[model samples]
Target chain A: MDATTVTTWMREIETSVTQERDRLVQLDAAIGDGDHGTNMTRGFAAVVQALSQDQEAPPGRLLILAGRTLVSSVGGASGPLWGSALRSGGRVLGDQATFDGPQLVEVLAAALASVKDLGAASVGDKTMVDALEPAVAALGRTVGEGASLADALEAAAAAAEAGMRSTIPLQARKGRASYLGERSIGHQDPGATSTALMIRALQRAAAASS
Target chain B: MAIQTKPRKFLNDPADVVKESLAGLAAAHGDLLRYDRAAQIIVCKDAPRAGKVALVSGGGSGHEPLHGGFVGRGMLDAACPGEVFTSPVPDQMLAATKAVDGGAGVVHIVKNYTGDVLNFKMAAEDAADDGIRVASVVIDDDVAVQDSLYTAGRRGVGATVLAEKIAGAAAEKGASLDKVADTVKRVNERARSFGVALSSCVPPASGKPIFELPEGEIELGIGIHGEPGRRRAALGSASEVVDVMVEAVISDLKARAGSQVLAFVNGMGGTPQLELYLLYGEVDRKLRAAGVVPVRNLVGSYITSLEMAGASLTVLQLDDELTELWDAPVHTPALRWGV
Candidate 1:
């Protein structure tokens, strides 16, 4: 996608976080510090504001800028996890004016790898990786099968929804929620849920662009 | 479900809490510290002491007098305070690391939390990229939590106080970065802590107590960040609570008969000094009976959860060297002796 497309994706994330803030906060309150919603909302608002300052930035630079803003403003685990994820994705997409399904898959894979590295989390850890890993895999599968970017994103978003639901009964193994151990079970992981929202936002952005 | 109540705090606004508190600290200890308004770091007045190993430590902000309050002559060279109960960013840590590098290298004393460890790890990498040698030790001394095989290893709590003291002293003594990191790790290995909460704490951003505690109930093995502890039970007498805490810490520490210990009874911010002192007496009695003798002790609110009415017992298995480090001259706003 182009710079404008990337900016739209960020604005879409801001809207999603704003709309789902309380749900994410309530979920975190069940197992964490009760601020994932607020943190995401704050981080993305700054990302949108920052992107406005450099509207003509390349796709990679736009994402790196957004990631840096999240790292500075989020002030929680999400700061580094999502920050590094976007930064990694941007670095992989370097200098591309526009990319296709293969590049999107590569970007998602790089994001997942960065998040897993930064958070030391993998599938079933009940973190953002829970949703992100599945989304990346789904996007890769659809794209490898010659699907369009919009269709691949839609598949990834659906898989992320399923991954988000998967956290409902798993005990948290990372983040503030992990401190609760068994108490964290039965609660939807706030990070995973927000990540599902984020992936869906990407799907919508891709659909609109296509 | 029950209705939650807003916590009562004296603040001009929720967003300004950390900044305002840091400003007040700078105002109160101008000679000892310089607060960086833009970077939001607390640096000792005489930092970058040539030929000395610089010690840097930080985490979330709600734990007052922790990384910041202890920045002084024999303690930390700098501390990066994050939003309340949130880990500080790598940028802040980078600034602190750069500000305190003394050519001998720098040591980062990180608490073992996912956020704290991750951010510190990033900052350490960034600093290393900048060609500054950095050594880091993640203290995980809380017996209430498990190890790294499953969960993030034990949450680093009360022992951070002793670690900062020992590491700071070692750095001030011109020890190499390795020596300071080694000494701090030793203290972490020898220390164990257990905390209990009689009430919940509030994050100003939310304005409500993080969790609801019914009347006459207490949470045992609570996290310093207001995470409900291992178990909740009916509130018991001070002596009864201290007995449980002592037993858990001693058992986890493996402190046997004739073992000398430094006992630190830390209040969870809202608790008064009288209560902490009384609990220390109980801790002392129980430790003596358990054959773990307390040769030195500190009873006060040092590492705290904002306005949470509780206390934690930290017992450091002491040797002559550690005790010497503990008694080393220190001058800080929250701690001062032998100055």
Candidate 2:
């Protein structure tokens, strides 16, 4: 992906987070501190603003800047978790002006590892990892098969959506929702849902770029 | 049971609530502390003292007079307040850490919330990167839920006040950073808290109660932010609520007979002084009867959830060192006794 395409994806995520703010809020209210929506909205808005200021930056630098901005502006579990993910992914790209599908999967792998490391969550823990790991695995598999980037992202987004929906039935075993134990079982994880939104934004940006 | 149903708070703008409050705080207590508007930190006027380990603690903003009001002599060196229920950013924390670094080192007292833990983790790393010796003591001493190796574990509650006080005293007395951290860890290990909410709390941004609690029902085992709670149950008398809270706390703490304990009864914002005192009375009686001797007791709205009518009970089994630390003079805006 190119710098402009990455920037478009960030804006797309910001728009998606804004539109789904209340839903995320409601989901968090049931099992958490009820600020996930506001936090994501604020974080993505800052990401967009940061990307705009450094329009000449390469895709790698833009990703790093966006991650740093989120870490500084968001001020929540999501802030450091998402910030580190983006920064780690950006580091894999390493100021490269453009990268192909295989490198994109590497970026996804880097993000997944960052989040898992910081959050200490696994696939069944009902966190952002649920949506993220599956999407990354799907993207890795599809891209490895020599598929186009758009098709790979489409599969990734679909996998993320499925993962997002899957969270509805699982009990939260990490984050604030974990404190609720069984009560956290029925509610959709706000973090997972937001992850799905972000993955879809990547797909949309790639599709539009093509 | 007619009551005030109006949703109201004295705020100029929802966005500037924390900033405006800090402004007023600085104006009123300029002698003790200063509000760093640019960095969003509430710091002691006498910070960065050459020979003392500085203490820094903070979390969401609504828990007023908690991280902020406690910044003064013999207590916290700095407090970082975030927006409403959100945690303070790492940049803010890093600024506070750097501003208060006294060459002796710094200790961050973090409550065990995901956001607070995550943000402080970043700040601690950055501080170390900048060559500032820093350590963090994470407090998670709530008995309202079961804590396991997995999950976020228990929510930190009323005992945080005790940890801050005792740890701050240790830091002020020329103790090394490790010793002070150990002191705070002791408090965390011995302290257990349980809270109950009579009504839900409204965030300034949302302007509505975050959760629904029908009248005559109590959201027991609630956290400072009023997260749905451990569970909801029928409302009972103040004395009954105190019994439940005391029972849960002492049981979780496993306070054995003939052991001396420090009792603290805290208000959850909207609760009146009259009610808090009454609950303390019940707590005193209950503890004494159960052989958990109450030695030092504090009663007030120290840590709070804004406008949420409720109360929390915290018990700390005290030894001589902790007792001495607790009795140490602390001077601050909201809580100060001995000079």
Candidate 3:
């Protein structure tokens, strides 16, 4: 992806987060603090503003700036988790002006690992990892099979949706939802849902580029 | 709006709750505190008092009389309240730290929630980049859960109030930032807290209860944000609840029969002072019976959840130094003594 394309994807994610803010907040209200939606909205809004100011920067630097903005602007667990993920992914992307399917897969994989490390969560922890890990795996598989970037992203988004759904029955093992213990079983994990939304936004941006 | 059956709270807009509340606070206590509208920080009017280390503390909005209300002569030099249950962003902390640095440095008394810890870490770094010295102490004295939603260890609850009071007094005494931080750390290490929630509380933005507890059900070991507790049990008598909470704290602290402590009984927002006093009586009796002498005590609502109906017990094993600091004069919006 080029710088412009990365910027487009961020804007898409911002729009998606804005549109789905209340839903995400409602989900959090059930099992965690009800500020996830507001926090995500604030973080992404800051990212968009930062991106707009430094539009000439390369994709890697732009993503890094976005991550830093998120970390500074958003509070609560999601801030550090999402911020570190984007920062690590951006660092791996380095100063590359453009990237391809394989490059994007690597970026996602690195981001997923960063989140898992920061949150200390695993696949069954009912966190954003539930959505992000599956999506990364699907993207890696499709990209390794030499699929088009668009196709890989589409597959990744679908896998993320499924992963998010899977969190509904999970006993949370991390994040604020974990405090609910057995009570967390029925409520959907808000972090997973928001991660799915982010992946879907990436797919939409890729399709538009294609 | 479907006939507007939502729970009514004394709020203008959900988003403006913190700002409005801080505005009212500053207005009411203009002589003692100054609220920075843009930065969302409440600072003591006499901030940057020459050659004195400053104490700063804050976290989410619902816990009133905490960081903000305690901003005065002997408590926090500055307070940074965020949106409910959310940590204040770095900008607020950096600005407040810079504004309140009295040439000695600043000490940040942070709660142990993930957000507060991360945000404070960033803020400390940012302030340090500007050559402002910053020291920090993280309070995690609630012995309820080992690891919960966003905490690595015990949640910081009642002990936070003790930390602010004792450490604030240390700063007031012209102690260095490191000394203040060290004193606060000692207070945290020697303190333990336990809480029980009678009912769930709704944030203004959410407009719905956070959790459901059947009538006569109580959640033991509740965090300050109304986060789910360790376990749910049928509502017992006031004495029974107090006994359980006091016992948990005393056990966690490993207090001997002759241990001298400062016992604090704190009310969650919706709980009345009368009920808190009733509970305090039980706590006093229980501590005395256990051979722990209540050398000093505090009772009332200082740190609180948003209208959460419950109480928390905090026991600080005291030493001469801590006792002297605790006895020092304090003048704040919520807490006052020895005028």
Candidate 4:
């Protein structure tokens, strides 16, 4: 993957976040505060601004900038979690001028670990982790099997979507849904949906790059 | 009809009231608060100390001292204030995370509102992309909307304070982000809250009440946004109101035969403490009769519904850990202890 590929992914993430904004907020309304759509829109809009202005920055640096912008802009729990994921992923990428499938997997793994450390949400918490963990694992497995970058990302995106759907039956163990006790089950986890969007953005970006 | 003069005088424009109020609040509480005017963020002036995981939270305007006033040594690391009753746009939340993130990572304590949850989720994604480890705990202790179809879900109410106090102490003791998150989840599980609004709030800018109610009637399960409640009922005595509210909270707690609990009697914005304590008196008695021991108690306005006249009751089953944290020193302007 090259800088252009990363840029394409960033653009995809922005678009996906925008497209899914209302849906995510609607899900959140089921078990959370009702500002997910507005919040995501504001954060992604900022990311787009940052990416568009600093075209010469390396992919990693651009991601780091985006992460910092998010941390400084978005409010609420997700801000720090997503910001850390990007920052951690960017750190892992370092100054590498380009990253192949294996390198992407490593960065993703590191990003996932960083998110886990920050959110403390495990696999079954009915949180973003539900989607993110599965997607990252799928990406790693596909890359390990020597699939092309686009194919690995596609697999990850599919896994993430499945994971997001799986959250519908989960009794939330993290975030606001946990407050509902057993009632939290039966509704889709908003965070998981957003996580799926993030992974799908990666897949779309990779396909575009190819 | 005669036009009435506005009573508020501290603002430049009606639109600027929330921001100006926050500015004044920060100045008065400067020792404990560091306000980011541009970002509309507030942080505990001292943060990121080794061995302490930061606790952060936030929401819209009107709930002053809520996400903001709670910022102190034992409460919150940061708070992002949003527009009136609207969730803080994500930009503020993102800024708060960066300010409070101390290498050990930060835990965002959120209310269970759709807007608040979504914004926080997006911010988490952004944070993930960055390197700051972030965790979130969504508080949904309110039990009023157990069966509502018109609303998003159950609203977060009184239990927010209990969650913040408990989680803040846990983080202060150097609990890992996971431990803090779990502790928050545990409290949410054991706690339940219910509230009734006696009146509706008038937005600072609009200067008109969001909804109108008959003088002799009260909205039974009124949410903070002046949303309709579970049902309307005649305005009753303090004891009578407390009975209904406490009953709702107790039933929702699902406490076993002999569980001990911490009770918080919170005042909505326009309610005075005198009235709150009167209601608390009834609540304390009813709780005793219910066979649940009131292990600890808090009575005051920790959370508000703009300027609405009402109160909410929160009951949490307490264990050793929670009790200890509840007893920890907290010095926020709204609630002060230990220090």
Query: What TM-score does chain A reach in every model?
Result: 0.98, 0.98, 0.98, 0.96
| lDDT, each prediction | 0.89, 0.90, 0.88, 0.78
Error of 1 at B108 (Å): 0.4
Off by over 4 Å in 2: B1-7
lDDT of 1 at A207: 76
Q: Write the per-residue lDDT of candidate 4 for residues B1-339, one digit (tens) a residue.
A: 348568454557875776788888889999988778988888888875665788878887777558788888887888888766666756777788888888888888888775578778877877888888888888877787763433346777777778888898888877998999898899988998888888877665445465577898887765665444656799888888888887888887778877889988888888998998988889899998887889799988778877789888889999998999889888886778788
As for TM-score, the candidate ahead, 1 or 3, is 1
Which candidate number maximizes lDDT? 2
Give per-residue CA lDDT, model 2, range B191-234, as digits (tens).
99999999878888766678888988998888898687778899
How do these models rank on lDDT, best leading? 2, 1, 3, 4
Which 10 residues in a row give candidate 2 chain A its minimum summed lDDT?
A25-34
Candidate 4: CAPRI quality band = incorrect
Off by over 4 Å in 4: A1-210, B1-10, B147-151
Put down candidate 3 lDDT per residue, B128-228, tens digits, no spaces.
Answer: 99999999889999888665444356778888888898998998888887899999999999999988999888888768777788998999988888777
Candidate 3: which docking quality band? acceptable
Error of 4 at B152 (Å): 2.6
lDDT of 1 at A198: 93
**Model 4: what TM-score for its first chain?**
0.96
Model 2, residue pairs in steric clash: none
Question: Using TM-score as the measure, which candidate wins?
Answer: 2
